[model samples]
Target: MLRRLVLTAAASVAALSAAPVAAHADTAADLGARAGDRLTVTVTDAGEGQDGTFDLECRPTGGSHPDPAGACATLDQVPWGKDPFAPVAPDAMCTMQYGGPATAHITGTWHGRHVDASFKRTDGCEISRWDSLVPVLPTTAGA
Candidate 1:
């Protein structure tokens, strides 16, 4: 009887140890891009109303972005950054000029992580960054 009790106790201990702990549940759930309800993006042009606000949801792809398909495709290319645009090369030079007063804020989830990108057209670099994310951000009527 004692031997049987010891065997049962050992089996119970093994089962308990092998079972996943509660602490890792949340971590496991957030492991990666979950389908059906995993992606969303919001962009505000800082202009004013509807023209400025572009909210998007990918994974099925839908939202206010002018070109949802194109915009989502572009977003797929971004890795992560305060700004997702590639940096200017060390030797390369950017023109020194003001593009405009238009600015934009992008925040949401991409892939499986958070995304927050800021854009402005104050200077050459700013203009490039802003323009680079087109349809995601609308183009001005003229220039």
Candidate 2:
């Protein structure tokens, strides 16, 4: 009986050990661990019939970005979501007037995740979003 009990206990231990352990990725650590990556940014101004493009490598902050440090800082402040880009506030109020034909397209990997985001100054809220991403986009809002 004692031998049977020991065998049962050993079997239970084996079963427990065989159970799969779920491993969760730590976001902050994962992001921090990545080497800086390339980001392609393009800005369009319909009023001027012009489009500007820039390639940026953030994190360590390099590339043609006007102010890589500031832009990366702004991006770093945002919390990571399953979706690469967080949704703008639904309850946010925006002005009706068109801020102009300023549009920005950003695509690449950030924090080891693929990112594709578009920005436009169509309203007050959108303008805010565009302005907040300054240097990341261009600085020619008035033009």
Tens digit of per-residue lDDT, candidate 2, span 1-143: 99999999999998787664321246555656557666898888834533677788875678877667877777766665544344467897777767787787889887777778888877877777777766577666463
C-alpha TM-score for every candidate: 0.57, 0.66
| lDDT value, candidate 1, whole model | 0.61
- C-alpha-based local distance difference test score of model 2: 0.71
Count clashes in each candidate, considering only residues at least 3 apart in sequence or on different chains.
0, 0
lDDT of each: 0.61, 0.71
Determine which window of 10 residues in candidate 1 has minimal summed lDDT: 34-43
lDDT by residue for model 1 over 1-143, one digit each (tens)? 99999999999998888676654775566553533322233443344442555667667878766678887777666765444544444575678777656666677765555666666665676677767777666664313
Which ten residues in a row are the worst by lDDT in model 2? 20-29
Query: Any runs in candidate 1 off by more than 4 Å, and if so which?
Result: 1-50, 78-93
